[model samples]
Target chain A: MTHQDVVAQLIKLVEPYAEGRVAHITANTGLTGELALDSLKVMDLITDVEDHYEISVPLNTLADIKTVGDLASLIQKHVGNDA
Target chain B: MKENPRLLAVRAVRQELATLGIDPFGIQIDEILSPTEGLIQGRRTILAGTNNYLGLTFDPDCIAAARDALESAGTGTTGSRMANGSYAAHRELELDLARFYGKRDAIVFSTGYQANLGMISALAGPGDTVMIDADSHASIYDGCNLSGANTIRFRHNDPNDLAKRMGRLGAEASHALIVVEGVYSMLGDRAPLREFVEVKKAFGATLLVDEAHSMGVLGEKGRGLCEEMGVLGDIDYVVGTFSKSLGNTGGFCVGDSDEMEVLRYASRPYVFTASLPPATIAATRTALRKLAAADDLRLRIRENAARLHAGLAALGFRLGAPANAVVAVLAGEKVEALRFWHHLLKQGVYVNVMVPPATPGNESLLRCSVSAAHTPEQVDAICAAFASWPGARV
Candidate 1:
């Protein structure tokens, strides 16, 4: 699947955890911003993402991630590598 | 207004806790009367928060050994184990731990944190995958990060969830490292070791159980939860801390794996850090022997755990898990938990106030660690303190 496709699906996953503050979750939506997710909620989101794609994301990768697009790109890489 | 998300988050949580005008983390025990009693603030308090399960801290044998070692061995080791610090006692303790578990070999680290970091990083590198429980300690998470491995967190204490995650790894499952704790520190609940061992075997994976809280508290022999659960032999690696049950300092890792000794050279945490102090090593050795020989202490702790658990329950407070040693009274919300902690303190009872994200889920906990040192009256007195709180009905 394309990175854009992953981003679209990720938007759906990120919505419920956004605390109703973000009306739209674009590819560039800041995870620490619009999502308003605390550290614990971010972890919950990561767990959901892993379950959805059945791919493991390295904990180190979170250091480089800030936006939904960055996460989608990383998730896409994991998906491709696992495939 | 800070741009740092981590700091901002902590600041927010701290503000909620700060409103109560008490810093639970900064509590100072003016004097320690025993393993179960201490002077906190100005009051003579029941020190329920200490993780002194075996209560060997003030044992005459332990104190005497430490004193003798201090006189003979000077103060510090002054070197790392890989360097000049592999004192005779360190290796002897390692051998003792290995023999205790019937493992082929063991490696002792500076602390339990380093034991996990050193072992996990050495076992799994860039190409490997690590499956850990979601509720694992911060040290375990740090180990995974340091390893730079593909880390997947399975549902806490759920073998089925782990199996699915391991299955998803495909070929990587064969060598994946699975980490779980025996008697998780937060709620004090134990892992289903048998079910986890079955999953490990099914996936052809390695299992590591950090029995930090369970050792010297569980099993008829005071080995750990792995022993109590009848799957001690199935675990590939067993790591634990002396700070808790041993009532001292330092950490250990015992395993029958062929590569156990090889990790000594490869692990940065082990190869670099200063060795444990001679006194701590000596005291722990004596404590270890005492823990092994005494079944009465273990039974005493279990009884105390049950009494406190039932006492708090009778007061209508919700407990996190069944009785065992750590009894967490779940006080929902950060503000409420903080208030409850102060209440306990005012009544001459002290428990570790746990808040998110340290605590699992959103439940704030008053974590009470039972000790063999506590008398039945002391345990009842602690429950009475909780019962005195008007919010006990929750």
Candidate 2:
């Protein structure tokens, strides 16, 4: 999948946990700051994304993820590597 | 002016508690009257959060053993086991624990936290991977951090997630160490040990089960989940604490692996910390023997847990898990949980208050632990206290 496709799917996966802050979510949205997602919520989001994409997102790879755009990029990279 | 990050966090938490008009942490129990009752805030309170599963804390034999040891061994062990602290009692307890679990070797640590810290850090190192449950206790997380291993967390209690993660690692999966708990303390749920064993065998990875909550609470012989699930021989390491069922203070790791003995020399947590006092060691030894034969206590605790769990659920409370000794009542918001905890305390009952980040799913929990020693009347009182909560039935 393309990066934009990854971002769109990511937004949908995280929206429910966003707690009515869905409108604030975008490619540039910060998972912690903008969405106010705690570590546990972030982990749930990561798990959902992994299951949806059928790809592995190692915890170490999540260290560099600060924004939705970064997460999308990471997912895309993993998908590409998987393919 | 710059402020310490830790202090800032503490201030924020304190402000929230102050607004809620409750202080649930570090509560002072002026007197422990029995295994199930205590004097808290000048009131006779039922202690439903002590995690004294077998209720042997005040057993006459245990008390006598502790006293005799205190008189003979004096007050403290001033040195670490690696130094002058490996007293005869410590070694004897280790041997007894090894035999109790039917394992070839066992190593004792001063506290349960150190058991996980020492075992995980010593078992997995650089170039290795540590796969743990997302809801694992903090000690396990700390151990992973100290291991210098690439750590990954699978969805809690989901063996499929663990299998998939292990598959993704390919060759490195062989070097992975999968860790899980026998009975999770917060939610009182159990891991799918049988399924996990299959995954571990498939991936050629080692499995470590922390039975801190299950020891003396499960299995015919009280050897924990491994024995209860008929997977004792398959588990690579079984770690547990004496603070819970044994009602003493210490931790141990027992296994059949020859490498287990090397941890005595390698684990810093074990080598550096002072050994448990002679009195504690003596008491734990007695407790262990008693626990092995007290199948009736196990049955009584489960019965008490069922009574309490059903009572709370009937009163319109959402439970985190099923009927277990550790019955966690789900309270949606932190403030709501604090209110419930305070209400229970005022009604002469006490339970643990678990809040965000510490509790999984960002949920708040009023964690109630049942003990074998609690009378049926005490259980009824505990239930009635919850039933009496304001708008509880509504």
Candidate 3:
């Protein structure tokens, strides 16, 4: 799957907790702002994402990942199968 | 599949720091002098960020006790308590702590962190649950994690939220250990002990209050929130540390003799970790003894905290919680927080800089922890430094 496809999947996962359009989760969309989720909630989301993709996103990677696109690229780069 | 998100996260943290024009982690203090003063960047600074609440670290009585212990007991235990490490001083300290709290028993640990870790983990296991406040210290979270129990958090200082979560536990709720702090670390707000006690009683759940920051800072004679709130006997467990107000390093769990005594043998963290050193036990004993009658010091400390809070508030800086020993200034973003911290350091005042991951909702904070040793002038100096900073208000 492409980076966009991965972003779409992750966006869907967080959509239930988010506002407006999931597609608006751009490369610069702050996860905390877009989803109105706290740190622990984001941690829970990351756990779900890790389980779904079978890829490990380190704590450092989380610091770098602000938007959906950045998250997708991280998964792609690490797991080599982003979606 | 081979990549490690953990290492990547560290690198990402470095990258993020670069982008934000700050350092995620930097600087090292050669020595921390006092709660109101320390040496940073080769300059003497007013230390307003340390959790040295009672200012007993440099007390003559405490220092003499520690010195005597060092001469008598050496530097370390160098072995777990279950091994050959439980010294006479350790047992005496435990007994003293129990008597001080008016509890039947008290179990001591190497550090405050391990006290929660050992007590919470041992009391509640995989099948049980640990309910904590969202604003609890990291040690509490670590304890819950170590327990292998299902952990849940209630909203900060909200008894209703705690009740709602307890209701979900159903019959298994009795096994849940509801934990909270007397004075929260970040915001410096006291827990609603009476309401929380009522809620815990209603649910038939056990309770544990970490008085790490409140031990000698509240209550008549400094017994902490339980005594001050008049719910001391009703609560199941009272856990606290000597590091903060007591001005030493160690942790203890005090409660009814029958149940708390069992933890001495059952808790892995307590049994496995080397016993606290003689010096710590000795100094802590002196501190605890003085604590039971140190109303004057507690009053002065409270006055100092209030003075700082009122001063900061007057300057239009958004203070955290109420006028308490801890005064947190909101900084919104990491870059701005770093800049504010740097500015404080340059002004010869040292405060803690907390940002995302560590802080709730990734909100950056400049936290100032007050102590009894802080004079009115020092408090005024700190406030003046903060007011002088243009970047701090935002």
For each candidate in turn, give its C-alpha RMSD to the true structure in angstroms.
Answer: 2.1, 2.1, 7.1
How close is every model to the real structure, measured as TM-score? 0.95, 0.94, 0.84
Model 2 regions more than 4 Å off: A1-6, A60-64, A73-83, B392-394
| lDDT accuracy of residue B164 in candidate 3 | 72
* lDDT of model 1, residue B314: 83
Question: Which stretches of model 3 miss by more than 4 angstroms?
Answer: A1-39, A43-83, B1-5, B15-25, B31-35
Give the whole-model CA lDDT for all candidates, comma-separated.
0.89, 0.90, 0.82
Which 10-residue window of candidate 2 chain B scores lowest in summed lDDT? B385-394
Ranking by TM-score: 1, 2, 3
Candidate 1 segments exceeding 4 Å error: A1-5, B1-18, B392-394
Q: How does residue A51 of candidate 3 score in lDDT?
A: 59
lDDT of 3 by residue, B1-394 (tens): 6878659767877887787665626756667776567787798988887778888889899999999999988999899878775788888888998888889988999889999999998888876788888778889988887887777767778898778767756686777889999998887788999999999889888999998888898889788989899999987889999888888888999998487777777788888888888888889999998888888889999999899999999999887789888888888887788888888888988888887667765578889998888999999999999988976476
User: How accurate locally is residue B369 in candidate 1, as Cα lDDT from 0 to 100?
Assistant: 92
Ranking by lDDT: 2, 1, 3
lDDT of 3 at B196: 94
Model 2 lDDT per residue over B1-394, tens place? 8978759767988888888779999589999999999999999999998989999999999999999999999888998988875889999999999999999999999999999999999998866889999999999988987887777889999999899889888888888999999999999999999999999999899999999999988899988888999999999999999999999898999999988778777898998898899899999999999999999999999899999999888878888888988999887788878888999999999999999889998778889999999988998899998887784432
- Which candidate number maximizes DockQ? 1
Instruction: Encode model 1's per-residue lDDT on B165-198: one tens digit a residue.
Output: 8988788899999999998999999999999999
